[model samples]
Target: MKNKIVAALLAFFLGIFGVHKFYLGENLGGILYLLFSWTFIPGFLAFFDFLGLLLMSDQAFNAKFNPGIPYSVLDGSRSAQDITVALSQLKKLYDQDAITAEEYEEKRRKLLNEL
Candidate 1:
């Protein structure tokens, strides 16, 4: 998973060459930055991008960059066993009135689908 901190650092340090843009999969923007690097405009723009990256929320960053699965899920390193345990935990929660039946069913469906 791409880290926000890493991306921000790239923008702050090597932004003059648009390294961060390339890391972010913005090939067109990276090319443009490379083309204008001689004018130092890319450097200034990269500074702003660095600030923006720092200010952006994790959810927004994940939605834009990671898509589908969030970084939190990837970071958990869940295997099939882990997913099974989680499903069991959800069932226990439902049985104990911690979660509603609909919530339990919905989460269970999602977990099963992942398998």
Candidate 2:
């Protein structure tokens, strides 16, 4: 779970090194930033990133960074529905014999406990 404040801080401070890009899981963008860091382009880009972070909502941030995962800001955690769906998928895998029974049981217990 990445924090907006942390990403903004990284952009403000170490964005020249593409730290914020890496933090956001944008490896290609991070590498490009690194390649052009000496040209001051990354600094300018980082400034824009800082502004973007300030402007972006938490839901937008999560959607951009976390992708398919559903996040619940009220509890600062994943939604129970997502966990249940994952458990159901795990069961399907187990039924197909894709995973050992022991593995399925362990994962099922872990997922249930998360609820």
lDDT of 1: 0.89
Query: Model 2 segments beyond 4 Å from truth?
Result: 77-115
Candidate closest to the true structure, highest lDDT = 1
TM-score of 2: 0.64
TM-score of each: 0.65, 0.64
Residue-level lDDT of model 2, residues 8-111, one tens digit each, is: 99999999889999999989999999999999999999999999998999889888887765666335465688778888899899999999999999999887
Candidate 1 lDDT, tens digit per residue, 13-58? 9998999999999999999999999999999999999999999998
The segments of candidate 1 whose C-alpha lies over 4 angstroms from its true place after superposition are 71-115
Record all residue pairs in model 1 with backbone atoms less than 3 Å apart, i.e. clashing: none
Candidate 2 overall Cα lDDT vs. reference? 0.88
Q: What is the C-alpha lDDT of each candidate?
A: 0.89, 0.88
Worst 10 residues of 2 by lDDT: 69-78
Error at 46, model 1, angstroms: 0.3
lDDT of 2 at 44: 95
